[model samples]
Target: MAFPFTPSRPLWLLGCGNMAGAMLSRWLESGLDPAAVTIVDPMRTDAPEGVRLCAVPPADEPAPAALLIGIKPQIFIETAGTIDALTGPETVVISIMAGIDGATLGDRFARAGGIVRLMPNLPAALGQGASILHICRDGANAHDVADALARPLGLALWVDREALIDAGTAVSGSGPAFVYRFIDAIAKGAEKLGFAPDQAAALALATVGGAAALAAASDVSPATLADRVASPGGTTRAGLNILDADQSIDSLVARTLQAASDRAVELAEMARN
Candidate 1:
């Protein structure tokens, strides 16, 4: 399929770290023209062929139509002056940095046409991700442009309140790591149950992948699916009994999400300060 949106001007990626690189790769694979992109990163040596790479924003070119800020949050202060120079009244600023709030972005890029904060997971590298967006302000078609950019990477979910982005950061942004931990735990359990380590790892990975796919395809709730799988007095039921006893799993996961969300809030506070 052709790229969903084409800007009148080129899109500039401010930092090309792993997450930004993954996003750029997906966008290129989805038919975005490499010529229409520019990356400003001194350390990025692997920019896709045909895209412009510069240590600093080009001096002669007009301000970019869109700017994706993928730099480390701690370095934002050092980079803000340079980035601000490249931002014009019609440039849409999309930021993936955690902890930085819309207000701070607006303050830093006062001339930007619009501001958006996005949180995307590692799965975005494969075009299957949950991207949570908060459109802080819409100027010069920012909302539509941001949506178009997000859809190619995964499910583009928007929240009415920017605060919800922090919650989403805790859930989808940090969720993959939690899932990985659970998969490893399953593999360890399998190894303890007499399976070879490689076999246990493969089984755990496939089991989780298949179950998640099934859950997505099914119309019924996952809890209902679990019930359907666990025939009365069966092995699955016995396992479910242990997991459900005292609601231990539910409580544990709740605490985990809460901790992540709290950290996101802290990061935001630090950025503002």
Candidate 2:
């Protein structure tokens, strides 16, 4: 079932950038009452049809039941204090800002029920995003609330080890950009091999899309699927051999994720310090 759209609990979304905007749109499309949300974003001019959008918290507005911080980690200092209205002990504070830990959040909003750190990818809009969740040790209720909110997106998984959330961010939060780059590389490679630019791009994109669909639909593992594609002495085998012999693709991808994860950890430390 889709997540319940009960408007009993109000939601406050602190920023509406691309990732956060996708989540907000998904929630609204999932039958959540747009009226339940109030988006606070200085630069963003619009919000879902029935939701309120403002540059700052209303002077005398009632505190929301759950507050989700969607800004970048670097800007937390500028925004954290302004969220005091919902810092009551019973209010769940969910943070989507990458690299900020729950302890730091709890310190900023000490009265909150608990702090939850959520890392989600862009694909969440289609309910197919991967979400990794975690919270401070004192945040059980906060975790449940966060999971409830994230469930509208696909594949919400809890990670007790907050460090792993950084890994998740690298693999999921920044992962889409990496995937797109790989698609672009594929298209360029195809073009270099004589296909027209547009034709090469179309085939490269369709190949990725079709391959992903097959992987998702089949029970067989991707490794086995590769075997299925590469029949003995086939052209696919020749290409596979080159990739495997040099370990080029896997090594490059590993390095990419490692770099992203390290940066996330660095950001986490910066926030902690």
Candidate No. with top TM-score: 1
The Cα error of candidate 1 at residue 142, in Å, is: 0.7
TM-score for all predictions? Answer: 0.96, 0.94
lDDT of 1 by residue, 1-273 (tens): 455335458889999988888888888988899988999998877678888899878898888888999999889966787788898888889999988888888888878899999999888888988999998878968888788788889889989899889999889999999999999999999999999999999999999999999999999999999999999999999999999999999999999999999998898888888
Kindly give the stretch of ten consecutive residues in candidate 1 with the minimal lDDT sum.
1-10
Let me know the TM-score candidate 2 reaches against the reference structure: 0.94
> Per-residue CA lDDT of candidate 2, range 50-165, in tens?
89999977676556677889888888966667675556666778888877876777778866777788899999999999999987635536766788889998889999888888
Off by over 4 Å in 2: 1-8, 137-140
Reference-based lDDT, each prediction? 0.89, 0.83
- Which ten residues in a row are the worst by lDDT in model 2? 1-10
Clashes of 2: 0
| Model 1: colliding residue pairs | none
Segments of candidate 1 deviating more than 4 angstroms: 1-8
Per-candidate RMSD, Å? 1.4, 1.8
Model 2, global lDDT: 0.83
